[model samples]
Target: MKSELYYNQDRKRRLFVDLWKEQTPFVDNENWTPPPLGSRFHFYVSSRQELKKTFGGWRTNETNYGFNNLSYDYGYYNSNPIPLQPNNDTFKFRLSSYNVNGVYGPIIIDMGTIETLNFAFFSGSGNINSGGVPSTPAFSINYYTP
Candidate 1:
């Protein structure tokens, strides 16, 4: 998923992302180790001064983290509380995960400084196909800046 920033002057910001699994079957069944279904999942956030920076000093928002199982029809939702400052203007936010796939967005914020937002997800080792017939999963992101 792409990292996004809020462009408002609000002091407090809330970031949220919804994720789910699509019932897509793995092509190479013989050589694939399916990821654990309905397993505990975690998320983290990273901040960067420049868009092209290699290391953006990643950090985990323990307050807004939770366990999610994407295989289910009802997707998982996670939110992080962010405090914005006037000095800390013009920064990018990146979203990452473990044992998760089919990510949707960074839900743009109406307030604060945000630019060059990117979306990403993990699809190898620990990502398993959903049980039963293939189906399309859902994912979304929302934020509160006030």
Candidate 2:
């Protein structure tokens, strides 16, 4: 199976990611886009907390940090909206493990404006006989200013 991803940021500063996917037996393909930013954007993680208690606030080994464990803090990675600087402003974030491909990681995108933004993703791989069949993709965004 293969996949692709896409994202769009409308004038309202909203973001959405879509995914297209196709399998070998199933020649058909489908696309799905995730919700925009600030639409119930929240994260529950414990990587930082795990390392704090295990390693005592020091970077010794990478394995100390695990997933979904109370050893670390479970909070939103980005709960606050990026401040637009004077003259030129850019908003960037790292995306990891959206589906399971492990190929798409950390993408930097420009926050064009405070409007509605959308994005998408597609996944698939085949020969000349088969078209570009991608797996389902998704992305979401949220904004908060202080």
Candidate 3:
């Protein structure tokens, strides 16, 4: 009986790991789209270290629809010599409704002098659809230096 119980536990653990792997995003690819109904996702922006200006937007298909609740946090690397001003090192924004029909936009934002940055996206309650065909949202981040 003990051996049977152990087998069941191990099987459950493997199943959970498989599910997580499927949900994990491939951060290395710029064109990699995230699961449309994912509750949370994050990516690092270290390649555009010299970029001082950044703009980006998101879009979703009709089947996936727009995000009911969305929020994001921006974090910069702390080791950099340049000191980030107040409200520069960390920031968060909430969007109650993001249009699903069209592209969100070329929203400009200050990236500061930080070389490495982390961007995370979170979906609000009832926003994620756990089952069904996985849909990926279209998004982009453009960087520029002056």
Find the number of clashing residue pairs for candidate 3.
0
Question: In model 2, what lDDT does residue 129 have?
Answer: 7
Candidate 3, 1-146: lDDT as tens digits: 00000112222111000001012433442453542322222322111111111234322212222333434444443443245332355545454654322222222222222223333222112121111112322222222111
Would you estimate the TM-scores of all the predictions? 0.16, 0.15, 0.26
Candidate 1 lDDT over residue span 19-88, tens digit each: 3322322233354355423332223322211111124542222222222232211122222223322232
lDDT of each: 0.25, 0.21, 0.25
TM-score of candidate 1 against the unseen true structure: 0.16
The TM-score measured for candidate 2 stands at: 0.15
- Candidate 2 lDDT over 19-121, as tens digits, reads 2221122122454354333221222211111111132442222221111111111112222224422222222323322222222122222212222121111
Q: Over the full model, what C-alpha lDDT does candidate 1 score relative to the true structure?
A: 0.25
lDDT (Cα) of model 2: 0.21
Q: How many clashes show up in model 1?
A: 15
